[model samples]
Target: MAKEFTDEDDALLAELGVEVETKKEAARTPREERIIAGFEEIQRFVTEHGRPPQHGEDRDIFERLYSVRLDRLRAQPDCLALLQPFDHQGILADAILVPGPDEDISDEELLSQLGVDDIAQNDITELRHVRSTADKRAAEEIANRERCEDFDSFKPLFNAVQKDIDSGVRITRPIRKEAGFLKTDIRSGEFFILGGQVAYVAEVSDFFKAPNGESDARLRVIYSNGTESNLLLRSLQRALYKDETSRRVSEPSAGPLFTGENEDNDLASGTIYVLRSKSDNPIVTAHRDLIHKIGVTGGDVAKRIANAKLDPTFLLADVEVIATYKLFNICRTKLEKIIHRVFDPARLDIQIEDRFGNPVIPREWFLVPLFVINEAVEKIKDSTIIGYMYDPATSRLMRTKDWA
Candidate 1:
């Protein structure tokens, strides 16, 4: 039933210099309405808080959910264009300029945003049972993880594991199907080389049965670079199976010192001997405080230095034994190489006379303090010496960018 236009309506149109006609409002699709509603809610939150919501668990659950939704909307160009007209806060333009992890929103947050409410008044036992089943399914899908507050404590383990890998002290083996890693074989303190990084199983929760009757456990996996994830055991197994380079680390290669052992292995052990030359040469006297010859001996240090005066390798002079470190289960040649490589930058650059009077430069002697040598040995025993380099300028072991 349309109302008839009278002479008053004609007079009003004529005054405005326009013709009289019926106007209709444009209709919006349900999807467009939903997008507009979601954006409007975000705008309202921004208006109330004076800033956009941020990610993390410390914030309210709803704010985190809104942050995730805003991230997703900002990622979609089509959604940005569609809601451009209603964006009075310049949200579309600002979102188009910023980038973030829009796709990392959790499933629980998404379900909660979809109006999934908690059941508070379940009077029937059958309904309660149905709700329990749904909750179990949600739990299985979500992986029941929380933030690892103690991740800093496990960072050194990953660093040590990486150094061991680099030094060939720890080797990776292919994760075989019969290795029992997927089932009940995963344990705490074990390490796996996955995704090209060292992954340590820092902690593991008790076993629980999932909906399918399979065993599942929560794991606090610490990765290289000090970050960690509290993922399910099955999830970790799936990641390892999918990754081609994933392997299980064998025994650590740095020796028993890393295991906090005070005793040496059963092999024929050697000693790292630091010798101070007893030469009266002018150059040796000038640099006596900074000069020292470092070597490894399989036998007694006294016997090794008995003929130092006749040997050109000892600078053709008798030497005094300053420091000797007993090392077991290690190759003497390799230990010598390690010490020389660590102190290579501070190698003494002086020509000394041999017994035949031919000037020769000894490469094993370095112009470094005795304390620095002791510190280097300690780092080698801990398998972390590779991460540090000898700084001649500062006379200390500084961390290297390559390893850090």
Candidate 2:
């Protein structure tokens, strides 16, 4: 060991033009070291790929892992700052990592987040006791796909969905952590992204409780690549949760009023207009009384709908203004949400392509009779609409039950 330098020795060294060495930073903790190592591996991947790793079922395993690791690093500024010195690729600026984690990411978790599993037993930095065998098998079940013999029947559906997304009828939203109760959203005919592939829930069996007592069901999931898996609903939910870049593909719905984005900014300055579509479509003609377009606008109702036949919202035909309720001091957007929520179950499920051949899901059209609409308006006036929901079976507004 070197002798301790006294103040006299320090002064003598300075006088002799000698420099004393000092530490620039505190010694890194094991966690910080691991974080840095993980990030360096990701940097290596970036160097080899010439692009940052991306999320997709079709991407290479290591690339996917690097992508996930990059995501985690970006989310933690602390991790990013810590990794800055090692960031020779300038990835730190673009979530390439300028961080050190404020977390307890164990070796197993780190490996899992990087989408690594098969090599866990070999002990990556002695990742012992990190993953259990049963859990490993369960995770493997998600990726084990079989040839889909009936994929031919689903091919047209997939093609249609792709078209809808391309035309703005459907949208894909990031599967956020805060998306409450994901399993509830997984129903028959729903689509999701898992392992970077488009997944469709072709069927959902009766719900049963797992060992943990969470609700689960057997799902016949079909993939776009002609493979299928009979995975449990809980498995899909867990996969979605673990995959940071996973997304939920929304169903085709009447897209924009083609104009709600603009009107959403307007305040309490519009009339609640109810109009009837005069389209010759068999269904519209048959149930014309039950289907009405409800909307709010700050401009004249007649002037607003000057060219109804050209607009998809009016069902590509002229409309008759059946009723109009003048409003004062009411936030039109909030009222529209309330109305939609009240009659959500009664919403008319119709998809019409516009002149541009883009799929459009019309908004604000409900299957309620005229008298019910009048009563709903009166409730809005008295602020009693909050306590009611439109009941199509009973043909009236029923008092909403407070489950909470």
lDDT of each: 0.70, 0.74
lDDT of 1 by residue, 308-384 (tens): 98887888898988888876677788768867887888998878777677888888888899999888876665454
TM-score quality measure for candidate 2 = 0.38
Cα deviation of 398, candidate 1, in Å: 2.2
- 1-404 per-residue lDDT for model 2 (tens digits): 97989999999999999999975988889888888888888878778657787776544455556676677778787786788788889886855433456564554565676556655455664443334555554455565566799899999988998888788676676676563435665678888877677889999999888899787889899999998888888788877877777777765542221222234453446788899998888878889988998888877899989999999988888999999876654567877887788888789988888999999989779998988888777556433455468888888777664212
Q: Model 1 misses residue 211 by how many Å? A: 49
**Considering summed lDDT, which 10 consecutive residues are worst modelled in model 1?**
122-131
Residue 241 local lDDT, model 1: 66
